[model samples]
Target: MKDSNQEEQRPKTTFSAPVVLPALLGLGALLAFCALYPEQAGRIFPSVQAWVVRQFDWFYTVAVSIFLVFLLLLAVSRFGQIRLGPEDAVPDFTFLSWTAMLFAAGMGIGLMYFGVAEPLQHFLKPPTALGGTPAAAKEALQVTFFHWGFHAWSVYGTMGLVLAYFGFRYNLPLTMRSGLYPILRGRINGPIGHGVDAFALVGTIAGIATTLGYGALQLAAGLHLLTGWNTSTAAFRLGIIVVVVGLAGVSAVSGLDKGVRRLSELNLSLALLLLGFVVITGPTVFLLQALAENVGGYLSSLVDLSLRTFAYEPPREQGWFAGWTILYWAWWISWSPFVGMFIARISRGRTIREFIIGVLLVPTAFNLLWMTAFGNGAIWMDSHVANGALAQTASNVDALLFRFFEYLPATRAASWLAVVLIAIFFVTSADSGAFVVDAIGSRGHPRSPVWQRLFWAMVLGLTAMVLLLSGGLKALQALTLVAALPVTLILLMLCYGLWRGLLADQAHSTQDLAPATSFWSGQHWRRRLEQIVHDSTREDVFRFMQATVLPAMHQVSDELRRRGVLADVQHDLDEGATVRLTIPDPELRDFIYGVRIAHRHLPVFTVQDASEDGRAQVFEPTTFFEDGRQGYDIQYLRMEEVIADILRQYERYRSLSANLRTHLLSRAPGHSEPMS
Candidate 1:
């Protein structure tokens, strides 16, 4: 009975019913309709897709252009220096791990599936240039680079920036609704916010399902070539989905640091190894020359390519335009919430400039190189080695990569290697996608249970399987594109919200006169040195919080109450004891000054604590504010000094509240206390 009571007392995973129920119901209805009426879906989806392309091709073109330009300009602007989290916060993951995870999540499967196919298709049938000519070859690579380059990353970078900026800086839930806080204020906690997250949740599932469907097809094709098995059957793909999704479920259970991180690193290592083999064995010099030429041609033609809708061309080029460029734009936009949110999750503590530049450049550089190695290598191999035989397999999109491998050194081994790489990419995509989906579904609660993540992984696999079985994957892809229209509008609004938030951030920063705990004078030098030198334990800090912090807070609360203000002193005993003084205000942010016990690892040069684990650490009483700013140690200050520090922070808050330009910021919903 006691054990049962303890089990019941454990915290349960909280799901935002507003977000989760609608997303699940909507996805269930869509998949059921597709399963029940596959034939109707088959006919209807294509018409809907074509109609959307014919009508909004220009909107997609222009919207993507705006995203790219906006990101570049923001990176160069003064607001670039703003950190995603507290100013003093450091990055959670190292540069290499962060880059690898993001790259794998962003475009891993697509690169494997399209690297060899896109270039060859364009080379054989150039949209405007004549086929089977040098011009077509250049145009082929140029177009490939354009599609996979800065524009795609910018779409991802924009969403990531919005989520990271609002979620971390404002101490808001890390969900889509947080980005709209400046415009909606507290209404983000209402039905409207739920709707946005629900929309994103449903769209992310479809987008990831589409990518996984493609990955499953390619994996089956690769297995067929290597094992000589009849992998073309629907049962084979179903098996592939089960196996990959099961692996993804395991990864999700292991969480980001263990499973996803290791798999991403391995995925990148294997990809580079394959790329190196091709570079060494294939037409090395020609491919290198083509890569350089491709970059030049892509950059020179970027503006025209960005805006070109093929409006003046005949129906053929227009159709190609709608099929290729427009399709890619829609696909990237639809996938942004998943990729963007994942990026944001891993990108706290980075400055806006660093985040944008890294997101825009790193993965893009690798993608350009990957496409060059596979795309240009295939094109060169077709003309020289295969005598144009490789070109014949272009129509078999799933098997094209394996067919390209057939013309390379150690064809069997390389084919299997590519298969393995694709499978891992499949797992990573599902793993990360499940994580992002669960986050959206839970409205970005940070402590969801492992079972919830596994549930999402299962859902993703089943959705892909159902669609694949019913031949509705294409229809779902089309629906995702239509969904991108509304997402684009939301993204534009997010841009506005982010801009306003940043302006307020800069204004708040400009008002900082001194550190809150910097009032120690030379007369208190002995006390300051004693506090810094002593390796205080948790007990010591708790004593300081009780003796020094609580008294100061109560004094302030007493004075405010006596002045007819509703001020209160609150004490919390959980997760490191805290004492806070709060002054309530309905029109603006409530003024909060808090002191909590914080622990840190002892520096290498410091005296060891000699704990049971042989690890050295120290604890200090630190000051925190209502806004998610970094705190400082206040253990060295006297109680009177602590009161003065609180008043200084309160003055700054009052000044910010009075600024007309920062009205949205002051009135925006703020945290009751700083986030851990």
Candidate 2:
């Protein structure tokens, strides 16, 4: 971890080479281009945005395709060798901490904005593909879940796993190389590595810049919705920028563990409280029933919905899949690399399988719940009261939550709560984004200098202000996707690397060595042997030697011990005829010598009494143990070293094994160097 205090001691204004000039140049060029070609830019911006989204869609398709291909190759690669490292010593956070941080970091301002707006939009204009009437209550919650569920979460989870495995598991530096390290481990540290890192950095900044831009626009919209002021005014835009920058700066200065985590926890609690209020005061029965039914619908339709392209022929409103669904998916995928890297940083010590399941499943569940409760409420109102309030309010996404509150019994109270909720949501989302961008820009370390974090935060706020001034939310959204393109490509590469790494791990863990029956094989081994040496020993020593070394020697040794040599050894030792003697092949003799040296240097283990029932137990050498393995006082340093060595050896042998070599050679001809 980088030292926060050390960072603070440095001159705050000193900018790193990577950030200063490029940022200025990029910002200047963007402003100039937009100014010089205002009309042309405006006309082409949507098409450009659409093209970017399409490219993301294409990138995702390619990623999924490559992932599938890798899966096929993995199936034929060999069995059971590749596996994630040990899961011992992983962090165990309190449920409250876990839930709060995850909820806050995972969702963001988008949830608050979409919570009411998205569901209501779908209810008023239920996708034509569903063959349902507008405002049909049944389709309302379903559509909401479609947009917020597993598909969106999958993008986040996949990217996070790639970063986590490569960053933590491999001990690689935090950069795009780390993200792509599983695939390009040893291949990194070259021009190729620098190129990968540069690409990642550009994509990350662009994506984060775009997100901040959206956040700023949404913040402006929220302010307008609450204050009834025109945020379109230059003063309001500047004011929004100032407020965002100030908030981010304060949080950045406070440091991540204290400021960011504290804010996230508070935001999460407030969101839950708001949800609770909705559940209590709103149509409770309706919300629960809708949630249950929609959850079922989401599960059953998940596979088809995830893959739906929403290709409606130029007639109806392109269905839910294209207009809202695909757009959200593309947006999530674009944001994945940035968000994923952040998640990976926070998720050190977690298993790849665990991280994936949590990232994909937990967030999806929360999204479903939010959509069901809030979205179903809108659907119920439209159906029962015959009010067009939700439909009317949804014309502007900014006012959706406000309108939802207006229809409630305690309108003023609900409005106030909604305002608070929106503010916290906005702050939490901004903080999360700032944290993620800091991680990316810092090359994966969370302990970024306070000033560095503040810099990014300010840049985000400023960029967002520019976008808002230029057009508004649409412009911000357009820019975000545009920036996300390169990041999307990097993520695709990450996916390939993750698949390869996992398969390689699996292959190494399941290697099998058996005796050869052919004379050719025996001769092949004999040619490499230099000599054999014999030693006489007591029955106990002979038994220990045979039990400890024979099986391993069978895999590497050439010749059997000679009876005459053993007799001569026994005679030299002056042992009785009944005493046993053994002679190791020269290679085996070297192996034994190495083992003895290792044993001699082995650290001493001091056992402390930890028996709960007052019974002392002998050390069990055959069983695996780590520190705290037997009530936290065994001091298993030696054990840990031994296990680590075995794991390293297994990895080495698996890479060199003929089966894996053949498999890799078959898959990619010139790229078959074993992953380090």
Candidate 3:
């Protein structure tokens, strides 16, 4: 068996240069064009943004609404029981750690930027309620919640779920193309696959660039507030980008565990500290009331908010749909690749249900709370405390959070804390973005060259600076919105691919893998029971896997090969022993039965001798398979029983493989690869 070091040091195969090179060149060329001719870009950006919004606004609304419904259906369906990886796999991070990382995804930056600004903006120009009054306050919360709520998460959840399922369950590379494997199969390794991956990478870069732009501006705002610095200059904001991006480069080099994870935890703690202070210093009871009211209003109007297009409204009100609501949808869609794949990477062992619930609900609840506390604090200060100072400078959205803190006690300290939070969140965002972009450019290997990661970090910093100079908020919003348009169809196709892949996998795993009882029954059970009740030991388990379990698997492999199927047994001391049967398919789930020995700790109560039971550890020979079912303990089973188990699994695999080969429906020419 190869040691852990060998696996860790294993060189990855070649990345698709065709995919990586072209994507970077195209995106970089456009960014360069914008940088060189800001005048032309300024004119073209609005026109393109307005046209796409006018034409595809309905598509965004319907696509997002469908994604929410799709998630609900999938979560409750039979597929919910499916594991992201093999059934024996366990979650990499604890629930708390996972939830913290989810929150620290720099969404706090958005909340910090918009939590107050958006609500106040909506309240000033009443979307539905009376302007600057009680009804408008409630309406403001509802609108803001809609922007940050389920729709946004649904976009993210769909992408993450699809990527995780395909990557883990199928042993495919963890890239966006893997999500299309149901339709594309091996074609996912071809040019078309490269195109898909390239498109996702480009969108991710643009989204991160936009995030860096906003984060830098907010950081600058806090600095100006605390120190009375001249951050009104664009050079200062550009400097902030350079410093954060360099810090991000260092973190990216340190990798996810050492850098990103630690930083995310820190950011979460700081964010909670700030949130707690806001809740206490501000009107705590009123914030609570607003939270409840905000959620209620959102729930009641969700259907309308979901489906509303402002169709038939005047051109004036309709513009809000194109700008605020539609803009948010595009940003979330663009964000899906970076955030979705990042979430999927950390979520290897979770079930489909757990993943969907965590992705769709946990961060969203945090967002609503964060927004209510912060946004409502701003509104309350405007009406009853600070005398409309926020609205007077609403156009400078970046400074609103700093100005709001000024109304509270210890203004400078609060502003400085907010600045640090944004800066760390900025670094974490860039670190993760570079990591994800590396994965895309390297065909799902995040451990690409250190120079490659730093390269992308530089690109992000430069992109942010150039775009900020070219058009500021208009450029950021415009690029993200335009970038998301072409990618939307890809996201939709991924959903369909996920749907088909699930059905295909369900058929595969459900094939009749019933055990044969003749040889392993009666006398065999007695011998198995004798072994089962004994005090467990490592030597005993290893001996069982080698002498009994492996031989039984070999027997099955021989019989399968004799029957014309591809079957072989491979064993190693560290990698364990396994018999893998491969049954190929053209367009659907491939048939595979890889049964191997895995270890689990003995239950403390199951230990026989008190001395050894309390102290000495025992290992069990547990079986695992490709279908990701909870494997059985086979250490005590006879050779005949092991053979029966292998046969049973193969029966299920072949049954599904045959059906998928014969029955998978084809899509239109452009929708899927040519039907095999």
Candidate 4:
């Protein structure tokens, strides 16, 4: 048996040079330029941002609206029945963990930075209504909800659905290129794929760096508020980045299951605690009434708000629309790849309906309540208690949240808690962003060294620092808005590819005749009973693979070659018990019939004590297929039965290939290969 410690350290994959090299070169070049020429970057970035808004603000608004509508349509369609992975595959993470992680990765920092700043800004300087009026406050919360609500999550949901569908269902690498498989076909394996992934990598870094910039500023401001130590300087912000990124590097090295998950749950808990504290201490009855009114107002105005560009309005209104709404849209788009990839990484095995609904509703619901509590409570305090004091310093957006906490009970503790939450949110965003960037650079290979994650985490921190040094928060937001344009185009193509892929998936399901191996139920009943009772050892499975599985595969391979069909069987070099037979098809997915020894931990009732190596384990020689269908143990099957099974799977593969409707499935590129 292998030591658990050694297994944890074992590397399963390596970087894809085609993706990694260019991405790093590009990132390094940008950072070097920004550090060297701060003035140029400051002017250039905002110019580019203004250009995007002037040229494509309508495009951003329209595309995001479509993404939301697309997801809703999919949820109500037959395609919603399709699972991300194989039909029988169960989710890797539980519902709570999944929600917490997605929430943390998607909007934790943004919410913290904008929760008090946004609503208060809109309230004080009303877009259309007069400032400091009842109508202005209502419109303020409504617009805040609109910006942070369904539209934001839909951008994420669209990217995530594409990745999960192609990556899990079609057995492609979980990278940006995979989402374009149907359109690009095998070209996804070439330079096109490399370029797509490189773009995604750069955009993810910019997005996360932008977010980290927000967190760093807010954290610095909170500390300054708490201790009055002149923490508002660039030096302090850089120090904050270094320390938080260092912590994030540590979390990234600890791996996702251990570090990101735990931190995300902690973030959610602290956020909720702070939220509850505010509601209890603030104008509780008024806040509750505002929550209901805010949700209703948002829902009622959602349609108009989704497509409203204010094109007919004056220049001031147009600028406001661009700076606030357009910028928010672009920020969400640029951040989609990072958040979307993270969500997809955790969302395998869920149905389309479940995935869309969960991704859309869960976070949006929380955001609405949060905006209402913070935004409404702030407005209420401004009117009733502070006499416009909170509104007075809303211009210093970073310190606004802490300022709002001052009028409440336990102001010091609440302020401290908010600071801690921002710090943790910073760490989670950095760590999760590191994981996503690494995945893209590695071409979505499942495993790489911990140092790679640390590398990306450092890259994130450095980028944020450079952006801040170059032009402060404006530079950060500008880069995000600018980076999102190209990514938006890519995501639109992703939508098309996803729709085609889902259609193919539905067609493939329709062509399923029956469970492929259901014909052999009790033909070897006695042998099956023996196999069931016997807890097979690794050596036992190896012997079975060598004696029974190998001969059967060779028999089929020889016959296929006799008929001039390409067939090859290869044994896994690392594991003698694992073997795979491949019959290559040039125009469609290859037919793969593989048998591998799967190690499973024993049930509690079956094991009283584990061996020194760790938990008690059992092994099974399970069959696998190229379509990612759930495999079953074939230990009881005789040599003839194994041969029969191989031929049966090959027939199904050929049959699926012949169906015209499975076009996208036939066009997807092969899985990621080992780096040489």
Q: Rate the local accuracy (lDDT) of all candidates.
A: 0.89, 0.56, 0.81, 0.88
- 1-676: candidate 1 lDDT, tens digit per residue: 9967865664587678999999999999999988999888777877887888889999989998998898888899999989999989999888999999988999988999999999999999989899978899989999899899999999999999999998899999888999999889899999999999999999999989988998888898888889899998999999999999999999998888889999999999998999999888898998899889888888899999999988889988998898898989988998899999999999999999999999999999999999999999999989988998988889999999999988888999899889999999999999999899988988787878788999999999999999999888888888898888889889989988998999889998887644534686667777767876789999888888888889888988999889998999999866649888889898777888888888887655323444346677888788888877899877777888888988889999989987777666677576342223
Worst 10 residues of 4 by lDDT: 604-613
By descending lDDT, how would the candidates be arranged?
Answer: 1, 4, 3, 2
The residue-by-residue lDDT of candidate 4 on 426-497, one tens digit each, is 999999999999999888888677788888898899889887887645664677678899999999999999
Off by over 4 Å in 1: 1-10, 512-676
Clashes per candidate (backbone, < 3 Å): 0, 10, 2, 0
Weakest ten-residue segment in model 1 by summed lDDT: 603-612
In model 4, which runs have C-alpha deviations exceeding 4 angstroms?
Answer: 1-9, 512-676
Candidate closer to the true structure by lDDT (higher is better), 2 or 4: 4
- Candidate 1 to truth, TM: 0.76
Best by lDDT: 1
Residue clash pairs of candidate 1: none
